[model samples]
Target: MKVLQINSTVNSGSTGRIAEDIGHFLLQQGHESYVAYGHGNRPSSSRLFKVGNEWDRRMHGLKSRLFDHHGLGSVKATKNFIRQVEVLQPDLIHLHNIHGYYMNIHGLFEFLGAAGIPVVWTLHDCWPFTGHCTYFDRYACDKWQQECHHCPNIHGYPQSWLIDNSRSNYRVKNQIFNAVRVMTIVTPSQWLANHVKQSFLKTYPVEVIHNGVNTDVFKPLDAPGAGGRYALNAQNYVLGVANVWDTRKGLGDFIRLRGKLDASIALLLVGLTRQQTDGLPKGITGVPRTESVEDLASLYAGAGAFVNPTYIDNFPTTNLEALACGTPVVTYNTGGSPEAVEKGVGYVVEKGDVDGLALAVRRVLVQGAAFRVNCRLKAENFYDKNDRLQDYLALYKRLCAVASHQTVYDGLQN
Candidate 1:
């Protein structure tokens, strides 16, 4: 069977790693799989569409969805892709965060639905069902519940001056998505799966498939040098990672907890600007982001506990990484993040429970050595890399079977 996977990006971070993992796994299994989307133009046995080097051009390409819900752009580009896909002729189309700057959503999904193809949409966020926002909780708005007339984040990323473009997006997406025969929704956590049920996309079957981490690169490290490199003794630190200072990720809550921490403790953060670092309280240290998985694994092993003060999350990779490195986690009870922490792995505090977070940190850092082992055990039980990948493979096959069976039934009735 042939498979086509689409995502906005396949590089730079965990999202990329995820796309790569699935593609490589399928390749080894002797199944033909290809990837589509921007930022991953690498010559894989599976890359169906190779986008050019122009970032702005790639972004502008997505605007074609607004023109007509049936295939974006001139016949030339659409024909080229359609021709390529015809040659590949995949049995299944798996989507992951396809809104970035990759292939045309309206064009591609419309085609897939019309062909009565099976579709497995692995939602990394709540983008597919919503009008526009990838993450609306950051804006604290619920216009998505009705119609997205006046968007709260118009001036934000993927800016649109036109009002109610969300309504159009919703219309186009619904028209196309409804035509899909087998739409399997895959969320990273049960918390997100539950949220999917509340959205306009509740019709499709939803499954929780926790993202897995490669433990070979993320296992516990014995080097005390990483501790000194970050200016700490063994087990003398805490770590946090995020793309930016998003309110939903709860940066402010972490800052408040930082203020109450002991002067001896240091909160090291990656993926923040110098200004963000300077704005942090006296004891918190800011480390530049490391793109290497091995480096991050060492960072986790060196830290006492990974602290996630995020107000909301689907399922944070930091929680998994900390556990993979034999480090505990202290995260909020909001969203699916707390579910990942589970029992014996770490502490789960209510949103803004700075006191509880700080206490969890001290317990793991100064005295909870045995408790940290529980974190590693939890990773093996729930997030083992092989198990997570296998789940996707099974889901893909199941979706394909359902899609095929539906096609035969409809053909017979006609």
Candidate 2:
């Protein structure tokens, strides 16, 4: 079988890695796998295709900034990509994060509507349904459930400096997205699937497939030196990590939690910008993002507890990584963050509850060795990378089978 996966990036961030893992799984199963990406170059085991040039990305960004027309620009890029798709004639097309200043959504969907190819779209965020924002929970906006007009998150990601074209964007998406005849939506968490059912895209089937982590790479490490390198004790530090630390990721909440934490315990944050690290308060130690998975695993293993206070998110992979590394997690009860924390594995506190976060960290510290076994067990049982990759492969086979049956039935009818 030939499978083509399209995403914003290759083997990079969470979504990119998911795409890469799925590609690798297909290749291992003796199937042809191809990955077409729009941003970032990363090593992958599958055939690689670059969707558009840097100039196209720049023009798309500019269009989004001036007109609030993200996903609608890059018309030529989308046309070129569609031509490539025709040549490949893939048995299946799997989509992920297609809105990162890359392909034109209208042209892509129009082709899908006519081509009669099966599509599986894994929504990493709320961007596909909403007109403006990738996430609406932070602002308590329900405009996406009806019609998006005068978007509250106009200044957020895919930010627009000039226009408010959300109403039209919503209408266009509502029309084009539903036009596809053979498509399925996948969300990493049930929280997101429920929201998809509420949106205009409710007509299509939705599946919840939680993101997974590589236990072999993320499992507990015996690096005794990991603590000394960060000036933290082996089991006396509270850790937080993100690809980028910002207000949404709860950088400020960590700063506030520092005051409530005991002086003996240390606070460490990974994935901070140089400026962010420099501006951090005295008690919190900030480290820039590390590309080495080994280094990240060691940090997770050494921590007493992992805290994720994100205000808006859909199933963060960090929580699974921490659990895989035998570190208990303490996360805000926001979106799908709490879903990773099964009972006895971690604690879930309300968003912005710094006091509750600090208390949970203290409890983890006290429980210490007790939670480690449960954390690791939870990860191995439910969040293992191989198991989740197999899930995708199973879905692909089922979808292709259904498509094949429908084609045969149509032929018989004719």
Candidate 3:
């Protein structure tokens, strides 16, 4: 089957890496796969398309001052993308996050909705339903559910227009999406899937598929001399990871947790600048994010437990990687991160309760080895290579059958 994957990115960043992984998986299974995306500094972007035109160029600074509509591109950019799609003639179009730079979403969806064969859209965030922001956290803004007038995150992502274009985007997306006969929504976590079911997009069928990681690469390391592991000086180590130390990842909680930890306990954080890490307590070690996956495994294996203090998430791959490496996780009792930590795999507590978080971390440290095994076990049972790859292959083949059936029906009508 020939598959076309549509996303804002292809290779470099987190979501781009995910799209690439899926593409490679499909290729290894003897299926023809191609990825289309915008030209970013990201790893391997093919089928480049610009976001806007000359008018856009003049208005971009003004727009940033107002709001940035992430998905909406210029009319010319949209037309070019449509022509590209027509030439590719993919059997099925699988879309990941479209919020990144590139592609005219309004035009592309309208065209796809009209030309629908089989389209599977993965909701990587709340951008599709929201007026602007990719995620709302627990902001609980119902504006997107309604007409999106007076949107909360108007000057947020996607559209940074001074006015609320929520109603228009919402209408267009709903009309285009619902018009397509073979459209399905796939979310990385059940938490996200449930939200999709509850939104204005209630009509679309939503399915859950957790992201997977390679076990061979993320496995335990017997010798931990790479980053210089501590000998657990009278206390255990609690670890945290963030591609960025943004508020969304709950860096505040990490600071608070470190303050409450016993002196012997160590806190290790990855992906922070030295300037960013300077103010933390003495025992908390700040390590720059490693580009090497093998090096990451050694770090995870050395930790007494892995902690993910994310305020919002949709199936974090980091959790999967830690679990694959037999590292116990302590996460909030909120979104999908907790799902990554099964019963014995790790601990989950109320969100923002530092005392509870610290206690949970302590509990995992106490029975750290057993919890570590459970983490690895969970990965083996759910996110192993064969299971995830097979699921995607089956989904693609099913879409192919549907597309063929639709083609025959269209021919008969003609």
Using lDDT as the measure, the top candidate is: 2
Ranking by TM-score: 2, 3, 1
lDDT of 1 by residue, 194-298 (tens): 777887778888988999988777778777636567677667778888866657677787778787788778788877787787787777777666667777788
> Candidate 3: how many backbone clashes?
9
Each candidate: what lDDT?
0.73, 0.91, 0.74
TM-score of each predicted structure versus truth: 0.87, 0.97, 0.90
Candidate 2, residues 1-414, lDDT tens digits: the string is 899999999998888889988988888999999999998978999999898999999999999999999999989989998999999999899999999998999999999898878899999999999998999998899999999999988999989997999999999999999998888999999999999999999999999888999899998877653656977999789999999888999999999999998888899999998999999888788898877778888899999999999999999999999999999999999898888897889999999899999899999999979999999999999999999888888888898998899899999999
User: In model 2, what are the clashing residue pairs, if there are any?
Assistant: none
lDDT of 1: 0.73
Per-residue lDDT of candidate 3, residues 141-233 (tens digit): 766666565667665555465666667767766666577678778888898888788777878778787787878888766655244654443
lDDT for predicted candidate 2 compared with the true structure:
0.91
Provide the lDDT at 187 for model 2.
92
Give the poorly placed runs of model 1, Cα more than 4 Å off: 40-48, 52-80, 138-146, 155-157, 161-164, 245-248, 274-282, 406-414
TM-score of 1: 0.87
Would you list the clashing residue pairs of candidate 1?
34-46, 249-310
State the RMSD for candidate 2: 1.2
User: Which scores better on TM-score, 1 or 3?
Assistant: 3
TM-score pick, better of 2 and 3: 2
